[model samples]
Target: MSDAEGSNEITTIENPYAYLERDFSSENFKIEVKNLPKFYGMNEFRKLLNEKLKLHSNKIKTTRKNSPYAFVCFRNEEDRENAINVLTNYKWKGYDLQILKAKPAPDPLVKKRKENAEDLHSNKKTKTEEVCSQEEKLKNSTIPYHNVEYDQQLKLKLEDIKKVLKKFGSELSRQNTELKNWIEKQKFLYDGLPCELLDIRFSDTTEGYRNKCEFTVGIDEDTNLPTVGFRIGSYVKGTTAVGPVDNLVHIPESMKVAVKIFQDYVRSSDLKVFDPEHHTGHFRQLMARSAQNQLMLVVGIHPQDLTDDQLSEFKTSIVEYFSVGKGTPAKVTSLYFQKIVKKNHRDDIVPTEHLWGDTHIYETIMGLKFKISPEAFFQINTKGAELLYKAAIELAEPSENATVLDVCCGTGTIGLCFANKCSQVLGIEVIPQAIVDAKENATLNSIENSDFFVGKAEDILGNICFKATGEDVIAVVDPPRAGLQKRAIFQIRKIPKINKVVYVSCNPMAALQNFVDFGRPESKKVHGVPLVPTKAVAVDMFPYTKHCELVICFERWDKISSKQLQSEELVS
Candidate 1:
């Protein structure tokens, strides 16, 4: 039969497979194919299916321009099954085609209505619980700590850390079993090294270890009075009532006193607590940062249609309460009035107006002074951060002639730590203010061999054209919780000079994927090289919480070519 005739015959063939009545719906019979060639149009994809797999499609749907996938609907399940059986793992245009049955799209209005109903129900339940809890706590009025219970909580946190690390190690082993076995067989730096189950770095002052707290400004559930604290639950989880943190064990005594004083001041004033649900009111949130006996306060207010004079009056009232009050328990080092939009809680792009006091606060880590802006990212546990940075620097093993590259170097804390040991340090960060802080920090510490650039790790690392200054170059990456991007991995691999990589990750589960991207042989094809994991250690950055930091050292398998190495030696 002619090809055209065969296509017509296949299109008209009867589907004899038994299918559910629901399968008659177009959604049930549709299959989505992803990772198709970007250049493939709907007609071209359909023709390919027909010519290659001899399967007919009733209708073909293409995504927007330049999309890499399309949808194919068959008349019955038999043809869909055949298509999946034939094309699920088939390579097309140098990429594996991913085919899956499309899930039914829900009606937007129906989904929204259901969500709203659920939210209403949850809010009511949460409010009732919060009221009961608040009444009970108020009646008791005593904050006591039980050693047994505290020990149990600490034990549980350690167990959680172990489980997370175990899972992370298992995932790495699974992804690169050969590498794991090779490290075990060979005398790697970490092979046979004593692996501590959990290293306890006791906080110098456990009661007030938290240097910062963000308290929501709302009415107390029991008293119906304006107060400052955390909400009973999340706003989306149906919690509208604010719970007092006066007796919260983690907060400092000074912070508790400041919060209580602020609550009283707000209650006496005409300001209204911002309602997240209704998106109304004025005072939204109180962000307090404490460092070395000084406090920085950022009062997030809506400033809804308030005149400059009115805003000035409000600011004056706050200053008087905190600074000039009869019995002020806390010294206000810096105060900021941040105008916040109710809907954009995650937006840090908005600027904060300076109201009073110093513009920045200084925190000393490992004898290095770091100037922190209100918007700058700093490790909350100051003492714990020292341990974390020490672990990363130790694993980095920066030689006297080595140049260290610090990726996502927030405030250049890690880079500054190793600046004295290394020949030179180069830091990259996305935030411009963070870069400024990093430079300031380097200068404050009198570390003259360090430089910081304001750009993403992926962008800057990809375009890095400089040669290594010494025998070996080391990279220390402290990426955010989302972990390193694929492009960042590609860039890291492209730099033949950087043989050792010290990855400091806050989230190991997310970092596991990055490990796979860095060390797996499959990734070598894209980047032309792969790194081998040498050693990893977990630091208890957050003792009470389930979070911890992992530091892994990866070494490149392929060194620079002979001529490049000779040239690098000569240059050094």
Candidate 2:
């Protein structure tokens, strides 16, 4: 008798078709079950199917930890079809099972056995292979450190920075100066750290700290519906499937709410979600930024093959829905529609059109009100950015007689922060719009000691460096994750008046070569004397993620070495 037909006392029952040979390798015999609840174990899952639903499967394969999908192999196509019909939309453990016919792939245990067999005859795998294996294990994960504890995550990030610094130290040692000895001594004393490492500073709140989030518009893997969320994996990894952001811990609830409302709006709209592979459809990405309970939503769309009137109607519908319709609950202060078209030429640029509400969002950091445009580069974490800037300023130690040269300054946040402590603040940025915001921010704060300039730092740094009034100049270089360009680094080194540079990097690993360039000996390509790193500290800007802001202090070593010699002589 079937499990459902038999009494509860019959715990074990032999399959009536045990004598019948079956081909489990065929696709008809396999069913993929998605949206598996995390609370259920393998044994519980088997019991739920065999006893609760009276479904029999020859083999069941569960995914690794934290994965939400599994596979079940039945004896025949008839049983597989029955299992799929019974399990689809079946509620268990608070999740409705999304069942689909799964394609045949090598089983995990069988694949492992084959790999082990091959390894017996082959030598040990290379380090690159091992790293690739580890990366493959996390290919399905969006947030790499979501499962790791917060404290342990911070330690891992600190170790990452130390490794980068050690590489920098090794390159610096080749210069064969007194700095080399200093680096060696520091490495010996501090366990591979090039300088004194301070305790990491944490954000005020770790959970839901992100003020800015960019969600993709695509098909969700679990529901197979057009969803607004982050991608499950990168496009390079052959997975463009989007997953809901309700599970991500870094996004603030305000942003999540906006995403939900927008998702509903898009699902009801006639337009289709943008397909990155085909470059078709209308909706592309949704960017939400929140501050003080106010949200700024930028709807990204690929206007492909739509007429002017159709586009206008689409825009009107969105504005009306966000203004008076269902999106009213989101408290959207700024609404923007961005036409996301790829560049056809080198100078081509697509500007975001402001639809309704405010044009800029206001964020108050360190008691200063700064205007953030749709495309402006602002820190994702507000409170954590305050800590990062504080560490940078402390490392800089700008005196009242000093001038702060904020290189690659975004919206003048860093420059204005230093304006109160220094005599003058000259901010240089590449984007003209950001410079406009920066100037307005300087005026908004009502501080006259700061000024913002537009143009690339390499082209404008020399012109702006001589405009400083103070005797001492401190350069604060906070470039993008790609780090400062080679020419920009050369410009900073060429500026003899700038005695100290406080480098704030969100990606220290990518900025390794930039640091090496700064400390390298003077050459034709890299002019001026080399700068030596004195101290460095880390600020935990993004919690539950493998990212942090690194603030490093670089000063003219000739002067520092002279002072050290004088102190040593006095001590002797």
Candidate 3:
């Protein structure tokens, strides 16, 4: 496709869905295919892989790595070599072949070694033993270095420390399995887990390990996705609400083992695995699978081991995979070479809108572009989000004159979704980029009755609605995993004339309980009236993940608006 340049010198090009549908075949070996433009979300790569697998023999497998560059694998080195040659020789997807000896898979005997090492459990402390003081900011402090020698010495220590830590950490992780199982065993003997959480999965990283689990207990009175601002919804990012722990509850041991097996399976797929934040590989699949937008294909590379140039190459290849437009024919370029030979490279992604011609709209259900950013929250499943919005609107029961508040509006999909049906919508978000995108999105859709504000929900919601309709105010809040802030809940409980609230929570497990706590007997009152929770619907936004989204409706059981909760809110 002849690409047109944008004002910013970013190129806009035709969509590559046509090329994606053409006949393609996988080289039977794990050859490294280099230098093609990636599609948004890496669909182009997936489409190519899918097309090749369909047209070619299934005996050979084409895989990707955590770096997300193509790595075709065969049953043996010979087939692998053959596949490598074909890929290197061909001009597929406008890129040239550059296959070489990728890091080989760890020997199968290593599995035996890992298993035997599990027996040395009581003798060593795992790296998980060195827990940072806090969860969010885990550290003593970042030490400043005066010289290159300091860096060299620390780098050496880092390797030794990593090895020792991983060894013991593995032991600790095994113990975690035992401990988690012991808890679950108690639950199985009885009816279920003693605590409200439904299930737990064990995961370990070089840094530490996390006990990922689900909770049955949920936020109270959550209904549909709240429409709190012009382009807003609810989702909490951090987890500060660690409740009191009760060890008396039983945990399931056998289930944990089975789950561990499943976890291992998920880690072996075509989806590349790595932490974009830490630049290390971690088996974060459990959480990744929870959202509709998250898709996991396991590649055999551990995230922590890729070299700097490899990382750059991986990022470029992955970015091309994530893009969806016609790729400029790949020739050896300074850019690709720099990626192929770099150190401490920071470039890992492309502004997808720029790469995909900026013409491709990130449309939600309403066909309005979503102001999605890398950091801003968007529904995990791009398509499934439509259903969620549709469901939220159904419960909001909007009229032409209804005023809507879309809180936690990451890119404003929910608010813009309901704008055509409502009188006006106000969207709120903490991300400046999101607010900018949300406003642009409204303009792009030519919708005038909506505007997005840049601020946290608790701070701006009161003033955003103060001058507006005291009645017919419908709030749709989709908070992050940590759930709503205490202040936001209080405001929801007491918002005068705002009797209807639709809560769309993705982290229904941990976050939902917060709402339940807020609406508990001791919670604040409406104008002299106490609040109550009303349950609604559970929508499976992610088909594969254990997590699900919930929409609940909260109506004032008492005659008071949340003005009564103001004193309690102030105390909090």
Candidate 4:
């Protein structure tokens, strides 16, 4: 009797495959089953399957940990067929099991070689076709000015910006009501601009503007060499192979040279390149940070049972090769060696040891000196950040008697910039190291008006008490991509004295949600007050990407009423 047909009282069945069919396809000797419980080991699963099907398989291959599938190969087609016929829709550990014939796994090297050959052919064909098409178009067209193409490109970029703004519910100013009405009448431009809109500023330097790059260390598929570059796919996708990046337009020449040097050193050394699958090997990643003419290199490694002397030798070789010298291609100001064990290891938890030179690099933004630590967050594009900060400050418009509160202030760059104009600047950040760096930066610039605290803004901002001097308070919040917490928004609303708020957001979609929490009257309110968004501007901080830095100005409605009352009293 079949396992399912047998009575519950009968623990052992005489014939397990009595109801299963013996006619199995000759081609399908491998049975693949999915939705296997993650906690079940290979041996236990194999034993259980054999007991139910009354069939034995020599090979049972399980995928990586937490993978919900396993492949079982039978000696004969009949056994495989019987197993599938009986156990195809079987339930295992409360999950419906899906069984199919497994295909042969592709060879990575062969697949890579074929892809490269096809890419070469495709590139050649595309180039030839483009050349012929361009020549034909030039000969046939009456007007061949390059300005026409430039104008088209500009229009496309503007359309993209408008699409993002619409997604975030951004509205055009009332002053452009005529334009808005015209846009509404036309079907083609109906969704392009809403009744309210935002102003966008273009970037000065469009290419090679990235100041920081994190590269993975692995073997290149094309060249079969140890390379330091970006991964072709993620670990979850099962394609952790990395490709060499020799001419990435986003990074500067100095960074590229530094990457090449590190790649060469890793190739020549006895150290093994990290493989994300097995999680073995020595070298894992290389993070390069550039500011002005100096470079800071942080090397991540998995020191697998290495001696102290061996580690010392490795560090010495890195220092001797990449350190600043007469013949070096890049000026490496700081070198850090970080030991990482897990794929998702936190930088704060896993300490980074300073190997050579200075521990921090100095970057000047808006005439203020800021110290950047290894793990501290700083804007990638320094020049673009200058424009972003300027927009934030202008929107804030802090008076001489105003006190500026900078939230999520990484290294206190924004707060220090406001120190020259405001009476006092208070900065808060969650990262402890970032707070330390911010304090040091304030001291470096000799700006004593700024005070930085280290904690989550939502938890700490509520308990902190402001001075009783009755100074006008303006908050400049520059949150990360995930945006601010709702409690943080509540705390901001609780502060009745705060009048104007300048919100600098790297991710506009998330920021829009925060605005809803603070602006909508139907939603939760703090102290029965809501903020109204007045003005907004978008600065292109990340060029050649779909991301932009957005700054929005919000004012308390009650404060505006109080200001109007004071103005009437002054007139009387």
Q: Can you give the TM-score per candidate against the true fold? A: 0.71, 0.75, 0.42, 0.68
Model 3 gets an lDDT of 0.45
Q: Model 4 off-target regions past 4 Å? A: 1-161, 164-198, 324-327, 347-349, 463-465, 522-526, 559-572
- After superposition, the stretches of candidate 2 with alpha carbons farther than 4 Å from their true spots are 1-140, 175-178, 343-349
Best by TM-score: 2
Q: lDDT per residue, candidate 4, 1-572, as tens digits?
A: 77665673232222222212233222237788887875554545766778766876646777574479888877687888888887777887787888898764433433443455566777744232344332233222212222234334344455655565564433322322323433243223444433233556655676578888888898776677888887755443334667765544557888888888888788888989976543568998899998877789999898877898999888887887766542167578889998877655243236778988788888999899888888888888888888888888888888888888888998898889888987888888998888889899999999988888989887887544275134588878898886787678878887877777888888876566676556544333455366655566777766544466777788875565476469779999
Tens digits of per-residue lDDT, candidate 1, 231-271, equal 65454343467778865666788788778877777777787
RMSD of each: 14.5, 18.1, 25.7, 14.5
Backbone clashes for every candidate come to 0, 0, 80, 4
Q: Model 2 over residues 6-92: C-alpha lDDT tens digits?
A: 853232212222212333133347888999987555656877888888898766877574369988887688998899889999998
Question: lDDT per residue, candidate 3, 267-356, as tens digits?
Answer: 343433332222243222211111222222111223445566865555455335333212222110111111111112223322222212
List the global CA lDDT of all models: 0.71, 0.81, 0.45, 0.70
lDDT-better candidate, 1 vs 4: 1
Off by over 4 Å in 3: 1-361, 521-529, 559-572
